[model samples]
Target: MSPQRFELLIGLYGDDRMAAILSEQELIASWLKVEAALATAQAEAGVIAADTAAVIAGAAVPATIEAGRLWRETRNVGYPILPLVRQLDEALPHEHRGRAHYGATTQDIMDTGLAVQFDAVGGRLTELTDAFGDAIAALATAHAHVVIAGRTHALQAVPTTFGAKMAGYLGELARDRARLVRAREEMTTVSLFGAGGTSAAYGEHAVKVRTRVAELLSLRASDIPWHVSRDRLAEFGAACALLAATCARFAREVVDLSRTEIAEVSEAAGHLRGASSTMPQKANPIESEAVIGMAVTAGALSSALYRIMEAGHERAAGEWQAEWQVLPQLAALAAGALGTARAVAEGLQVFPEAMRRNLGADSGLVMAEAYMIGLAPRLGRENAHDLVYAAARRCRATGESLQAVLSDMVPGEAAGAVAELRPEDYVGHPDVAIEAALARWRDRG
Candidate 1:
């Protein structure tokens, strides 16, 4: 495929770094690296002479192989490693040719090589996730006291700080980041079991060779072969899906808050940053929209991984091949989603005045619960709720503040108590919750 085919779309929906890591060249190079490591490990395990291992390793570089011929022969062979082995053998001295891919099967090299690729991709993703979290934490800290209307079922329900909203995003992302980190760690394990989930080909040196290869590759070594046990790969995809969903939640909120009627928050302004071609008076939440798109696509792609896990027996009939197509795309979509989320968050424009304005949009009915609680002590709880309910209806109908309506309906003592309740004062422990969230984010270091 032409590399530039998706260039335009990639800028909005794909991650360049992730794409590079999972590219064809990188995939071939990873396979070559695995061959080299296998030779080195075999030498250490006494399966091959050290000089022979060196000769194979020297010839294992991708430059020594013909990509066109390898791929053509792979088409006929139904696998690439045999063709790759043939190329490596041709590059080697006759004596060392036989030792090139000693004791390793096609799946062994492909799976282990994929693990190496995932290591790079996972590290990049973790960095992006952490950066996004940092931006959110900063927003949370900056807006800790900036109160906005808290909405439920699309209607104003109470008072809440924008910082607390940011903190909520931070909290979910922190947990998702942890899950991704763990899944990446688990997924990066070496796949050295020979054909049929057995190490019989390696004879006495199977465990040693696998261990040495894992050490050289900086991957985990497992005691059993996962030839058909694809849970690790499935888990990684699930984690990515979860992260995308969390980011989408935050993006959805940004889109809502940036609505023309709401106008409480906006994406940063720039020259045609979110420009409309025809309508010169429009600015959109472009990054957040892309984030949502990437998230939805990632979520859909990740679900396919579960089907891949249904592969039976010692090897998959065809399910294993699905991962090759699904994992990279899933990871790329997740990276795109997270990276764009960070961009939106870092450049987010928060308007405290707009937030304050929106808080009063419902004629101060949002503070009814606060007022009801304040009056509940003097009047009975049920009576206080009934009185506030009546006051809220009048406040909404007359376009007056809840305090004004309540004062007209209640006695002097109750009116005095209701007057003391403020929207800012009723944000409900956001300071404590935000601080705790900030502490958790810091500790993720």
Candidate 2:
């Protein structure tokens, strides 16, 4: 949140969703918009711009001379767009001062300005979400055939395809992608319900301007006032929250697999990977950690947005303006998170042998599920359950192999049960379920 970082996040929202919200060009554009709106409304009402709209539009250029001069004038308002308004006034000469921003509240121009900013920001979100989806799907495919120990409650449970685990993550991100789309669409609606959220000021022409602005920005315009209907904004923030949470979840998983105790997987080692200061043996997943940390800030940004949505009725300029900062920050955050996530996923080092070794480290004990299922048919459900359960209990007590205990279960002693069982027969449908999940993904497209 340093000043420079705060500013960079706004631009970098091109990569993630939370590091930034609005851009400088965005603020200027919105000012130019208020200028344009006034000019458009004036022309329709015979006030101005039947011919001067082009002049007004050209004045909005981010690199314009007037914009530079306005920058100098508004250096300290904490709201620079107002200086642009004065500068535009100077540019318009006299007969048009009345034509400028006529019959408009600051909210009128500011709201439309935000609508325009959100339009550009929303487009970037689509791109980032697409990248995240690609990363998850790619990870799922790459590891789909690699067997891994599926742990439950921090203990080994059964065998599973690494791809199956990744696919579960991918599924979560898929829902996230949909949530982002909905959030963007909801936030994309222009706030140009006109002055005071009513059409009284511009007479009959207010209707046309509202509709035209929505069309110009490729956004939907509501039939009624929503100056207080902030749910749409909350939707945008929530979408970012989901994306951040996804990143954190993915990062934590990477960290876990890279742990010394696990060592089943590691972040793809590269020349740029983190190095140790003392051990010289550590190649820490720093990028993964960074991604995890970013989630914290991104979540905060989403909360800021949620809080802003509780603004007083009609409009709240301060709260809305804060979004000018918050929204871009989140956008940049999600973008960067996705970028890092892609890098981490694509480079993951999976050890199938390690997975197999870990899968049954507890003295061939991970075969309990298969043993139960296999015995159910031979031992008449209840009897089979009691026998196997007792055997498993004895194995745990003595720290002996489950196979050793099963070997003593004799032919008639356990209702014709055999002791020559292998752990492979117990993994159930892990491979097939993984294959089917991937197949379903392919078909989903």
Candidate 3:
């Protein structure tokens, strides 16, 4: 069977989810696009006659090609480019066959083909990021005023706005989008340096070929020969995995929130969810768990990509093939993770009532910070801490309110500071961070 057919059958593992990036139509379309680019580059540099270039362009249509036949030739030649070059050769009507591919190396066409795919994949990633950003913003808007006890060491340490917590995630996502954007450009550059990592075939024509190829493909010209660096390829792969890690973290948070005992938040579930024999009433977060599971594998693939960077010299077949396996898979998984993360964020339900109900453990003593601040002017900083420390223990152990505890320990100036304080006065400003995230996304297009 054809490589294209294989991908269609197994590329997405039972979920077509976001496998368009690896589809026969998409991958083969990239090859056709690069062939047209090669034709354009050759014609612009006077290497191929204008009329011949036109014939080559007319025949590069993706839909007209036989994918199975191309795959057969590729398998026979033991290289992916053979099918592409042979197909281009047959379509040239004999007159332009000799001029096709011109002075370009195999890596040149392969890298260009890869860039075309990156262009399409980059667009999808941007859309996924945007959808997730909208979801994050909605969460921030909805929870802007929900006060919750922020914890460290699994114990409440202070009051924080739930919106503020989401703001931090929104900030991280903004940075992730920026990194993905840069990785897209890095992956999309034209590397037309000829065979053996040099432009020897083109000779004095190398500069013209490089410049024209970049212009034809709307990509930057690679300065040094990147035919074998492999680092750029790995960086692109690593970025995808890193984005997956972010998705994993988001999924983990959802899982934490959905825990029955915690109940501070929950993933919205439908009637058919968790319909297994054992747990009919359960609302298991299968999507979140699936996304998190993909993240673990994506991280491993990322490490493999970096290992390929150690494949030094002109080229290493083993390392290159490893990349072909890992990078596309990483991209596919990242796309799925981002898509799932956006959905979770969009439908995530916050229960301020639950947060308030959960805060009974504080016994109104989570307001220790306010009391500390209130007494800072009275007993001096050190003494006020001593008094509040003594009083806080009473409140925690005996379930006493701060007001009652403070009555016994009130110092001269603290009486004045304590009168103005309230338990609800300590929530921090989370809306500022949300606005910052929204402003960052405005320039995404």
Candidate 4:
């Protein structure tokens, strides 16, 4: 019944749990929760009767509020809190009606509601990210010694294990997880400041009321009202963008390795899951494609959030309004990217023989670096590089193997060094790196 891609067709590019967290119904429920919490805080501070606070709390459930009327009034009033407060007050008994919203302002309810939603979203994202990292660690451990061609700038440069490549990604994911955890902790704070964030209306009891509200909502109380200081939200947005970019990096690797010419890896398929319309033999990297696409969208949305950080004065005219649209989209896109990445990691198909075939395709030219390093002690560094360069050109021109060319160009110790050099021999401690990455993931768990 939703109109957006993240809602209507969420299976393709969104997580249902994340979509629900950001849904309109949930937003309204969060606002009502904030109103109830504010009433409770005021009651604790002697600003309202305890019985009235309990009555307001009992009446603040979303089911008791009329959605259609609230929507209509929100449109007429240019904000939702006024209509929401009026509706909640009407739902209360005559004696307790006035205590519905207490001394809270529109932004107080709205901002605190956002914080509640953010706490839920952050927890879900953390769980998904941990699952994805575990999958990566498993893959790395399984392929710890499985050697493959290490590509640099679209060409094979040397040898590296698949585990090493996955380890690189795992390291980035760990850092991303840490950054997101910090940002979430910082941003999920209660926003209970009064109209102008000064709490002047509450006088001496403002801090106590704020603390009580935060405690009721299970959130952190801010030292000062952050009505215009949006860096916390911006930090969370930036972390999400970084996570999406990492997912895209992993997906891009899968896409390239699964290419027709490469065929070193692919996404698992069943029936006609990844089949093309015209080409019957096609089994596309659909999950990887989705991950990359969602990552790109998240990245763009994160940049928009950064721009919206400069809310004018104590409150914004347009910047704050823009956030209401951008934040949920960013969350949906990030959740989608993480889910797609998890699928990719769990169901990846690796072809060891195909990798070996591709690694051997260039007739041992990929080992040139190893050969040059071997010969450097004997021929001087510059001379050894020059010799290898000349031998590489000759091998390419004559369709001969680099080993054969090097055999003719160098003799004795230099030749022995070249003969000893092999693709697998040049992997350079990949297992050590992989173990280190897996250990980090384990520690995080």
Pick by lDDT: which candidate is best? 1
Off by over 4 Å in 1: 1-8, 411-413
**Candidate 2 ranges beyond 4 A from true positions:** 1-21, 41-47, 65-81, 379-397, 409-424, 427-445
Model 4: per-residue Cα lDDT at residue 264: 91
lDDT of 3: 0.76
lDDT (10s digit) by residue, model 2, range 146-239:
7677778878776667777887777677677777777777776665555568867666667676766666656677667777676876777677
Worst 10 residues of 1 by lDDT: 1-10
lDDT tens per residue, model 4, 132-159: 8988998998998889999999899999
Judged by lDDT relative to the true structure, which candidate is superior, 1 or 3? 1
- The best-first sequence of candidates by TM-score reads 4, 1, 3, 2
Q: Local error of candidate 3 at 268, Å? A: 1.6
Query: By the TM-score metric, which is better: model 3 or model 4?
Result: 4
Q: Candidate 1: lDDT over CA atoms?
A: 0.88
lDDT at position 66, candidate 4: 87
lDDT of 3 by residue, 351-444 (tens): 8987876655566667777788778876788888888888888887888877778876796545777763443477755567767866776665
Give per-residue lDDT, candidate 3, residue 149. 74
Which candidate tops TM-score? 4
